[model samples]
Target: MNLLGRGALAPAVPVFRVFGAMNARAPSASLAPDVASRTALAVHNIEVVYDHVVLVLKGVSLEVPEGSIVTLLGANGAGKTTTLKAISNLLHAERGEVTKGSITFYGEEVHRLSPNELVRRGCIQVMEGRRCFAHLTVEENLLTGAFTRKDGRAAIQADLEMVYSYFPRLKERRRSLAGYTSGGEQQMCAIGRALMARPRLVLLDEPSMGLAPQLVEEIFEIVDQLNRNEKVTFLVAEQNTNVALRYARYGYILENGRVVLDGPAEALRDNEDVKEFYLGLSATGRKSFRDIKSYKRRKRWL
Candidate 1:
């Protein structure tokens, strides 16, 4: 039941470990060696319930250190999205609420803040499925992320260009309707829009869903660039365990609304249980579909 006690998971492929050795950037606080002291966001034993009835999240707790990438990994329906929505205060829109515990951003309690208030505090969420406005031009969709800023037009425009620098493909498609762009381009737009907010923390959900493998790598590479260059912290919820581990410094695995396993990303990559269950690998090698199904029925951490 204690997966963290196991050996480290396998390392992600070479390309995915591009930023694995970079040092953590100092936040507003004095440089601290430990993650706890430098945490940008902390979710402490929070529980989320939908419509005051269906309990969705049960004591979910995780942290994202400032200027670091931390991933939440799990299968579909494992409460990854709910955890993100809880942090961004978007739960209220869906009739869901965090019924207990606390969520803090930059050490201030924020579970009660409005979604826009959270955004104003430099925290934002890019929802899954590339939620771009169908009728809006790609450039228009990116600019909307700046609505909360009181900063003048020059600053916002500068940030827009910065977004274009990171996502040149988006600039190429800027005049096109977001709904007309390819899935990968739309995903880039969603993230580009998040960048326009100048957020210190971005809670990204399922960024790789429905994109080709190459596109997934391209997107994550941009994430790496943003983290290193912009000092933006990311708390990513992704089903693509292999790619997520490659780019993130740390990872948490969720199941049925609870954190089942967590460790440094390299450790998670080499973990046998993670490889077997999430990555479809075992000590013996890649698992066949039948083997995976059989193994799933008897998951050790379940």
Candidate 2:
């Protein structure tokens, strides 16, 4: 069956591109004036601190234009998840807080909003690990995402069908307990649940985690479909650089809590450093683990 349905066209507006970290002195110059007006989210020189002591993110800044797919690429412990949590206002739950800088959603400062308040304003996070309620049936798990909505059942039911349309597999297993489903299905359930909230911006953390390559492709394909047809904006934090770059229009690379490099996806894909380090391919040939490890010490961005 066709999951994307009709009216799925490529985004009309060009993605606003920013390279390197935004200059603290000239932050306004990072994005073109026209493009800035269309931004869905903007994080400016933000710093995240855990336990009021350990710093996690340092002066990281980026933008996600409305109706576009943006990817955050990095290895484990690179602050990718922390950045998403900061944007979603989920940091307080873990004793983390944004100590500096500002975050804005749709041109309004939102760093101080509560998590559920953020959800009510149409921004939500589909957390890592597909955190589904294990005992809840698949459909029930999806319904939980709509808890903040005051819209009548008719509207909610229409959206439920819309979520099922994007994920027919969810419809097939609607009665099955979420814990009994496969990893891929659980990932779908997580994303489907976010859709039930009728979100405008979905912060997706590691959607490909623990899934097979084919399943990863399926998950990303669904994300693309949602962006194209439903006009949902996505900010995906992923470790799989190749796949993320293939689907995202723009990307930011994080390391040690700092944004070291960022640009249009095609530019990043062909970049020498990205090809050698992230893609495991150098001008000579594919490198072994030992070669990559040796090259890591001299990463140009460092």
Candidate 3:
């Protein structure tokens, strides 16, 4: 049932091979938290480059409010993963660098901190592709998340139980090699591992990729529960706008590495442009819009 096959421990599985760059000027703080006091993670106009030539992420900016779920939505190759890596400082390994702008977490400059330091500060990024240690057991992979922690064993053990509570399927596969687990279980293992880090902010990349619709819903339900019950804030980058918006309080739509639109999730669901361009709907799903405006007055989405 291993839908992901033998991918090994590639947490940030590379999907796109190309990168590009442009002059990145910090955008206005319009997207910064309305209450600066509640901001957990902030990225201001960052430019990313690969191998000092190919550039990606042209001055992207956004904010994740403390203890809130925010969805970053876009199509494939929209620089979503790059933005997450830019914040986690993982770009360096890929010959990628944030050539412009800044990132802050809990009011501390993230560029100045190592990846481990960010984890220590309760910031973690659960990379895409549901990467699990192919040779290791599910429990072992989950324990790896706590490798940077020096906290007492008791706390870690308690957290392990908590992860099991959130992902019972992972518990069922606890002793199985991660490589053999189903795609859904591996995805659960990835998120459970991040939880072991006790992160205050989790940058989740594509939680719904390569799974059955039912499994996707189940995982998202767990995410919502974790957010509500544990106060774990999430900034999820996903292409599945329909599912993501259901749980997110706010959303930002990115296209070609730029913020094209952003607003409360409900408002986005009603936007003509979003409905057509992102949702693939041509004002045909809802009849209320037609009732509210004449056909001639309806805004053009394309």
On lDDT, the leading prediction is: 2
Ranking by TM-score: 2, 1, 3
Pairs in steric clash, model 2: none
* Candidates, ranked, lDDT: 2, 1, 3
Clashes of 2: 0
Report the lDDT tens digits of candidate 3 across residue range 1-302: 12112112212423222222211223222443334437888898888766676556767888788878888997666678888988998777777789999999978888867899999999999999988899999999999999888988999999999999999888898999999999999999999999999999999999999999999999899999999899999999998888998888788777656665677778777777667556767666644444534433223321
Question: Any runs in candidate 2 off by more than 4 Å, and if so which?
Answer: 1-37, 289-302
What lDDT score is found at residue 280 in candidate 1?
A: 71
The residue ranges of model 3 lying beyond 4 angstroms of the native Cα positions read 1-37, 286-302
Model 3 superposed RMSD (Cα): 8.4
Worst 10 residues of 2 by lDDT: 1-10
Comparing 1 and 2 by TM-score, which wins? 2
In order, candidate lDDTs are 0.82, 0.84, 0.79
Candidate 1's C-alpha lDDT?
0.82
- Prediction 2 TM-score vs. true: 0.87
